[model samples]
Target: MAAENQTQVTEFLLLSFHGQPFLFILFLLIYLATLLENSAILALVSLDPHLHSPMYFFLSHLSCLDLCYSSVTVPKILANSLRPQATISYSGCLAQMFFLMWCAGTECALLALMAYDRYAAICQPLRYAHLMRRGLCVAAAASCWLWGMLDSALHTLLASRLSFCGAARLQHIFCDVPPLLRAACSDTRPSRLALHAASLFVGLSPFLTVLASYLRILLAVLRMPTATSRRKAFSTCAAHLVVVALYFVTANLNYNRSSSGAWPVVDTLVSALYCVLTPMLNPLIYSLRNQEVRGALRKVVGAQGTLRLHS
Candidate 1:
């Protein structure tokens, strides 16, 4: 009887915020803004000589990750809002989960790298250049990318082995490990263990690294002789600190909740904040808080205006 009742599910119904026109328009606007902001950051970091430091190098990568991260989920959310029945194919869902985890893990590691960059610049000025040399920076960034890919590959592999016996409707907004595990009928112990392991290493470990880096930075800043130096040091770290707080707080809320119950509205809002809204906010935070980025933006705009006049 159990065998007879078992049915294969080829598509998952994404019922969260389905057929909501207001949300469709809102997400469309947010997606466009996210693209514009991240693209501008990439252009500024690449073209502007002033942003050639280790800080903006990591910032550019952060913007890239934000772009990929938002693209993975927001487009689908916008499409689902317009459709009567929002659905994703089995393969599509797995692919989404893969890239989503990839970007999330990469961003976590990248943020930690950015913190260390600041710490080196502030706490060890004498060794800053040697500590963050070009080759080492490139290698470190590459390692972070590799770390994220390997972590995502393991979780995606585990998730693919899950067997869904009946309806496979994910309770949350998008394809993610938690909801997928919830929907599976097979033994989820391995997947759950993998998730717990990732939560520790990929998520919590990076956060702890960031915390430690900033703590050292704080002590160094306090030891500085001049107020101006202290202020300048704090200014350099302000944007990254805000971004770290925003990303980790939302991530923990989204992933670290108790697994026993469901709150559809809260879950959807938190997911949207983490996946949709945060990307749009990151560049804004950087540009507003960091004078270098704003100066670069002005230079780029002025150059464009001059080119138009010359033409």
Candidate 2:
């Protein structure tokens, strides 16, 4: 019975914010800005030999993840904002959810890896080089991507099996797990449990690891002799902490919420913050707050200027 019902849902109607032209335009600008910002950071990291360390290696990957993360949903959002009604095929919806989950999971792992890198730099300065060697960094990054894809595949597979009802309208902007589970006529217990477990494995567990790393870092920073050293250490961790807090808080709130009621407005707003706002802000936070990134940007700009002058 459920399988028969599942076959009926050909496509899903995504909730649109197009009626508000001002909001649509604002989102369009944000989408473009996120892409450009992440792209610039990625290019700068790749081209500059000064940024060829473990820290910048992770930073480059972070930029790539942010770019890919926003790309998963933002283009659809921009399209939806311009049209009267927005719809996605069932397979397309599943694909979107899969990629989004992949990015989200990978980000969680990367953040934890970054925190560990910071911990080594601050507390184990003597062994920083040995601890975060090129081989280890590459392996860690590869693990993040590989594990994330596997996690996402699990969620997407479970989601694909669930039988969706005839009502093709999704209350939220995208085909997220929570809302999609709510649309299913089949027993969603297994899917919800899988989601919760995956969240813990990919989200909560990594967050806890990051928290522990920071706690250790804080202890080390306090023991430093000079105020300048302490401040520098704190500054290094601060931007990352802010990004982590924003991402986890919004994601946990939305994903862990009871799926009984369909709150389109609330869901849309929350999704916008994580899916839209976070990606836009990530490059800005890292570039503006971190002197190293700023210096690299300046060098890039200066080099461009010199090249144009010669030409």
Q: Considering every candidate listed, which one attains the maximal lDDT?
A: 2
Q: Residue 235 error for model 1, in Å?
A: 5.6
Please give, for residues 100-135, the per-residue lDDT of candidate 2 as tens digits.
Answer: 989888988998998899889988999999999999
List TM-scores for all candidates, in order.
Answer: 0.93, 0.96
Backbone clashes under 3 angstroms, per model = 0, 0
Q: What is the C-alpha lDDT of each candidate?
A: 0.85, 0.86
Best by TM-score: 2
* Candidate 1 vs. true structure, TM-score: 0.93
> RMSD in angstroms, all models?
2.3, 1.5
Count of backbone collisions in candidate 2 = 0
Model 1's alpha-carbon lDDT is: 0.85
User: Could you tell me the lDDT of residue 118 within candidate 1?
Assistant: 82
